[model samples]
Target: MNPYKEIENEILNASHILITAHKSPDGDSVGSSLGLLHFIERLGKKAVIGHPDPAPEFLQWLEGIDSILYMERDGEVLKNHFQKADLIFCLDYNATDRVGPEMQQLLKSTSAKKIMIDHHLNPENFVDITVSATEVCSTAQLIYELIEQSGHADLLSEKIGTALYLGILTDTGSFRFPSVQPRTHEILGKLLGAGVSHHLIHEQLNDNNTVARLQLQGYAMSEKLEILDSCHAAIISLTEAELTRFKAQKGDTDGLANLALSIKGIRIAVCLYEKEGKIKMSFRSKGQENPVNILAEEHFDGGGHANASGGISELGMDATLKKLKTLLPVYYKSDK
Candidate 1:
């Protein structure tokens, strides 16, 4: 049988299902998972939402956000649920590896049917059924497709629609990214018809930043940012001391890449934050560069989109910059 057909049939029949996404859940991951969980629960089935990391504070107001389980200290709850689940829906990520170490182990040992819905590139080998289409802007779009295909589109409650809408809207950078397509707009229209409050979602996400985060942004611009190589690239470093001084939190540095990309000729942007004796790096490309491959293969242990990627480094800021300076020359050799 076709894998999707089998997966759909399983979804329709399964009494117990668990929903999950990649670790360090983003808007798209959290939104898609919660939206689908709510939809499944409406059918009177048992649906449990499991997250290995804390969802961002700004998105916590969405329905079913409280149902999320962060298994950092106590992961056995997730292991128990994964073991008992009849079916598992993994969204927004291309691989089980991205789901973090603890969750991945539970997924591996479970007898539960694994179905993957994502818009990323080639998937890992773990999933039993995979529906990955790189053309789509966000996994929320894929969730819409699942609801449409299940003949349950009318059951899309306002809560579900709003959650899914946040996924699509934020992942596309409010429709400013190149990934936005006709289907994205169509889905947004449908979501609006379903009574999703657009203004509320925007305000909840965009305007919910704390004063400390705003101050961190100001300090980053004034002190820590460095434009390099004729302003084709830029780097912003945030030391732990600086984080303390500004009282910044984890999500505070989320959009720092966008700030550098706003510069006239800058094509690549990087934000490095020192956290817990490790440096966390976020990379973004505004032009024709694939930062994911660079970070994944060369510098860090992570990969994401061609234009946007992130990773973690063991080296300090000075050493990392020396390596980045040496490595980045390849991308600019022709221009030089």
Candidate 2:
């Protein structure tokens, strides 16, 4: 319990602080970065966020998002911050390579005492102090614990709570994921007590979708969703041409895998779509019987939780689909 108070002491001593997350930032990464940024500001200190890339459009409505420095577009500004930083907080991502090439190089070169707050499995040894709890649903949860253990409960303002709440909410799939614990609810209660206005957060997250996103999702589900009756698995694939035709933006297909998994007979759901000339995959499974992380790690260059994982398919859609179908019997557990 609070061994050496390392995180607390570091925040107090560091002058130039920088926060960062992985490339193609998701809800958890965006939420945790902004949340920690707000938390540090509440301590009357200055910290800048140097994200590797832009966050999804759905999360842009959150406060302080505009201040983020992207490595792609704001290279000079981020470089300056990286050079002068005395402490770097790597959020959401584990390995240094997750930040992409240029940002990864900067992270490797920086002598700033790096502390990582992540919930991913198999954290790398790049950071000086790593607060990784794979059991926690999201990195935002770990941030809250840090705040509490640091004796800064008074600093948990509405803004900070809202940002953290978004992280925990999306990552846990609204507390439905198996990773969620009873303590998760207790932390959520504190966030609500601190005026998170969760209903509004939900609306802001889900309601502001563009018409293009709706049409794209609709087309993907109706036309692309393929059910393998033998193994009770579902798969959806979208090509680059189709994504461009609908003007699909980032986060447009965020929850489509979950949608496929909701079907009565489906136990495993896989969503593959072309992006930047590579096929990206999201795999979802129903219960403990089928763990998709193994399939993801072995077949695709990806890994995460047992139930929800990500993978990449360098092979084109046609070949990737054939390979996936061929491997389904080996990975999926049939309901015999």
Candidate 3:
């Protein structure tokens, strides 16, 4: 039986609905959640969108973006909604822990029927209904499939199409990632036919960068980036002072790891930036030459896609940098 049919049945019977995505909401998370919110509303159902943290500035222009309640910012109100909800839709993330501490606790305590719609690998078996397809290009594309399969394809208006297109655009690295299938392009065509302005979405996400962000990117590439010729890797590390000097915002370092990957001989790119006393890492690799996901999981306690992943180090700046340098040669040898 199709699990989406079960999900549809749940949605039909439910009244008050709650929607949420992972913390540090990215385009896929926010876009998928908001796209579903618009779909449910069109069905005449009352739904509330909650996010664990603020959506990045670049995604703020999305329709219905402001309607999302930040769990960190509006805890009391979100808690009340959680209590009243008959159904909870968890989007993008595979685990409840990905929503952060407070929201994770509330989700665990809620009696609401939990439905997970994600494209991430190794999902936790927490939700009641799991509609996960790890091979899908993005969760937004999966949401589009869900709505179309559930017989609500007509509900996909321009607003919803735009949101869905944004997710597909970002998560697939502007359709450059190998994860994008022919079906992804088919959906992109349909989204465009549905009145989604692809050029506008691209401009707003990529072209409307602030001068400070560009300056920071320039500084990181020119001064901070280090090339490891032996391992065919590049790394960029930013201390808290550097971030502060650049006036770095939440999304400033979004694609810095990819920039390192653009280096001619660099197969693996790593970005280590300090945030709140811990080193947060983003890893990117070109084509599957490195298997950075395994490197992240084994060394840094993180797991993601084959080519892109993230991890963290509790070690101080210098120590973490030293640790990464130590691991590269060993991991690259084993990977080969």
The numbered model that scores best in lDDT is 2
1 or 2, which is superior by lDDT? 2
Rank order (by lDDT, best first): 2, 3, 1
TM-score for each predicted model, relative to the true structure: 0.94, 0.98, 0.97
List model 1 lDDT by residue over 1-336, tens digit each: 544446657877987799888887889999899888887777666688888898867778887788787778558887788878989988988877888888888888888888898987767878778888887889998888888776778888888899999999888878877788888899999999999999999999888889889999999988988888653788899989999999876588888988887777778788989999888888887644444446544568766777777788888877887877666656544263
Q: Which ten residues in a row have the lowest lDDT in candidate 1?
A: 288-297
Q: Flag the better candidate by lDDT, 1 or 3.
A: 3
lDDT of 3 by residue, 206-318 (tens): 88899999999999999999988888889999999999999999999999999999889788899999999999999988775677888898888787888888999998889
Q: What's the lDDT for all of these models?
A: 0.82, 0.91, 0.90
Q: Among all windows of ten consecutive residues in candidate 2, which has the lowest summed lDDT?
A: 1-10
Native-referenced Cα lDDT, model 3: 0.90
